[model samples]
Target: MSHEHRHQSHPRIVARLKRAEGHLNAVVAMIEAGRPCLDVAQQLQAVESAIRSAKQTLIHDHVDHCLDARNSEAEREELKAITRYL
Candidate 1:
């Protein structure tokens, strides 16, 4: 799903996402190379963990900035939507 453009994601979150993208690419390469099932499974798990960590970072940032004051019902609902996906 698309997020708001005004919702400025932190630099660290971007970096984490970039790293996760690299991990995903590596997993694709392994699949193409005829890797064993267990090896590929481990790599997949690593990607999942990375994505989860990234999600947490974004959630923390949103809570600290956008939702800190508890104003803006729309923003709070949006943040809730983001959290449910995680």
Candidate 2:
């Protein structure tokens, strides 16, 4: 089977990443504004969580919609490559 990838969740994932980008910008502004370390750390954590969630969603979507069981060798390699980020 051909392993042409499809991303059904692209819009949602892009929105999520945009939110994370906004949060990251806020974190940078907070640091420049001399916000307390704890508050900055919390915002940074939120940004990290958002990015992680987006990544997992993308990876899961790829595995669900792209992987071909009949092509186990190639699919397994792709799975390993994608999962390394997690």
Candidate 3:
């Protein structure tokens, strides 16, 4: 398939993002429960880390499956853009 077609095809990534959304909601609940600041901070940090890890997994999948499938240098470079979030 063409790069154009695959550029927006992110089913696996959508799943990871959905999971991250659940993680985020849990963190919010922790805050509403009057948890200690340090504990909340830790949970927030874990959520951030989970999000980053999920993003990296999605990026790697895009590079190996989508970008590489199309053999497009541009798409491959776009995959590197995930580093900006780190």
Q: Is candidate 1 or candidate 3 better by lDDT?
A: 1
Candidate with more favorable, higher TM-score: 1 or 2:
2
* Native-to-model Cα distance after best TM-score fit, residue 78 in candidate 3, in Å: 3.8
Please state the error at residue 47 of candidate 1 in Å: 0.7
Query: What tens-digit string does per-residue lDDT give for candidate 1 at 6-37?
Result: 34666777888889899899999999999998
Off by over 4 Å in 3: 1-15, 66-86
Candidate 2 lDDT score at position 45: 92
How does residue 19 of candidate 2 score in lDDT?
A: 94
Total backbone collisions for each predicted model: 0, 0, 0
Predictions in order: lDDT: 0.79, 0.85, 0.68
- lDDT per residue as tens, model 2, 6-65: 577999999999999999999999999999999999999999999999988998887776
The collision pairs in model 3 are none
Worst 10 residues of 1 by lDDT: 1-10
The true-versus-predicted C-alpha distance at residue 66 of model 3, in Å, is 5.3
Give each model a TM-score: 0.76, 0.82, 0.58
- Candidate 2 to truth, TM: 0.82
Give the local distance difference test score of model 3. Answer: 0.68
TM-score ranking from best candidate downward: 2, 1, 3
